[model samples]
Target: MHIVLSGYYGFENVGDEAILLSIITALRKAKPEVEITVLSNNPASTAKTYGVQAVNRWKLKEVSAVLKQADGLISGGGSLLQDQTGMKSIPYYCGIIRIAKFHKKPVFVYAQGMGPIHKSMSQFITKNTLNKVEQITIRDEASKQLLVDIGVNKSMTVVPDPVIGLDASAFRSEWLERQAFESGYISVSVRDWPSEVNFKQKIVESLDLLARSGHNIVFIPMHDEHDEKASFELANMMSEKSLVAPGNLSIEEKITVIGQSDLLIGMRLHSLIFSAIQATPFIAISYDPKIDAFATIANQPNIGHVEKDDWNGEQLFDKAVDMLAERSSIEQALREQVMTLQSDAQNTALMAIDTFK
Candidate 1:
């Protein structure tokens, strides 16, 4: 089978890259003879990294040509369908699906976090485009509810974030040692939010408390430059010393780092997902509904919402301490979910691939 994959690819964001890796891994494992192509922002780099044929996502001619040669297109595992972040992607991704439909090929929506899509135009386009797909596998009930509310009554299933099924054995524990970082860290994954809330300051204060208690604080950036900048900014404000992990770590390396953490207090959905891949304990901070949504799915603590919670981030430190105390039970809860999710995630690929028949 030849499949053309699309989503927020070729971007420097670690979360999307992880999703790409997971989807590619799932597809190949489901059908070892599968041939893959990617629609990416940076086609050359994505092609080189994943060892797949790639075309610039913005080049409609190239994307159309690629789709013509493939068996089908797989369009997500991320928040690609939502417009609260921006409206451009709804039209862009939907347009790609239409291209595949024009070729009379199958298209699958793969485990996307589909909402908080408030704009009427976005809802209209999303409902229309998605209703036509062969299958729609969303990551959470909230996303499925959003799709149903928008009137996209398709064959959809809610599954765990596909990254939860990512092969953790591939994670290189030696990579962290090579970077001269210690294990058993309190790994933190964070990003910038558009709100005026000073959540960063609150997070810094929480880390400072953890650091004072002799726990090593390591800020793991999910995106290279942007997250590294956020990490440094937070670390610089801390009364106690904290480390910003070296930038440009591969997806596998990032997982290794998070997996080895004593606890992860994270904002990025995939970072928390990384923690789950290895059964590490975590406390999530929700900048978006997807963050809290995954936290709930993983049975972890989500201290507060960035926009609606206390500016002091007192709950973060408290949750971290409590999670540390109950690590054994927490790990068990995560393991049960991880086992089922891994199977479901793999089957999701099988389901998508079977659509070709």
Candidate 2:
């Protein structure tokens, strides 16, 4: 089957890239002969990286032509329907599905994390578009609930994030080769979020305490320069030394880096997901509901939310200390959850493609 894949692609964001990777991996494993074309912002990079045919997502004629020849379109495994990211997000993704439907092709909504769709127009359009799609698999219960709240009445399957399906056994990172990592280290994944609170200061203080207690800190940036800059800013404020992961590490490499760490303090959603995929102990600081949702799945502590001005340095440090001491139990708890989610993610891909059958 010829299927066109769409999402926030060709962006250097490692989280979205990992979603694309996991989706492609699962789909190809389920149907080896499936022909895949990606609609990406950076078509050449997307094509070269994933070894799939690619077209510019913003090019309407090109997208329409591609969808016309394809059997189906797979529209997302990310937050494509949210107004929080931007006003255009919901329309852009919904528009793709509409174009596919216009060409008499089935469109599968693949493991999207829904809403913060505050605008009525976005909600109305999303409800209409998704209700018409042949099939959908959202990443969590919250996403499913959001769709229901927005008036999408179709039967939907709620699965874990596709990235949960990545196999860490085969993961390898050349970046973590050192004595500090050998003893034990913490991995942090952070991003710039708008807030008046000094959440950064609180975190810096917390990490310093952890460092003084003899734990090494390693900052793993999930995106390109943006996350790297966030990491650098945190590291600079930190009195103790910290190592920052290079900007060029691939998605697999970032997962590998997290896997090697004793604990992960994650602000990015996929960073926590990576830690869970590896069964690594983690502490999630929620900047959004999606972070809290995934934290519950991982069975870890979510210290607080950034936007809510809920940064507690003592609580953050104390929780990290507790998680470190109870690492075995936390890992034990996550193993079953991670395995089940992985299986669900893999099966979700099969279910998505089987819509055509």
Question: Could you estimate the TM-score for every candidate?
Answer: 0.97, 0.98
Highest TM-score, which number? 2
Q: Model 1, residue 201: displacement in angstroms?
A: 1.4
Residue-wise C-alpha lDDT for candidate 2, range 1-357, written one tens digit per residue: 988999999989999999999999999999999889999999999999999999999999999999999889998898899999689998889999999999989988999999889999999999999999999898889999999998999999888899999887987876665433557889999999998888898899999999999998999989889999999999999999888889779888899899878899999999999999998999998888899999887788899988766567878999999889999988888888888889899998898789755
lDDT of 2: 0.90
Off by over 4 Å in 2: 178-182
* Clashing residue pairs in candidate 1 (N, C-alpha, C atoms within 3 angstroms): none
User: What is candidate 1's TM-score against the reference?
Assistant: 0.97
- Candidate 1: deviation at residue 92, Å? 0.4
Candidate 1, poorest ten consecutive residues by summed lDDT:
175-184
lDDT of 2 at 81: 91
lDDT of 1 at 15: 94
Please state the error at residue 293 of candidate 2 in Å: 0.6
Please give the RMSD to the true structure for each candidate, in Å. Answer: 1.4, 1.2
Q: Distance from true position, residue 240, model 2, in Å? A: 1.2
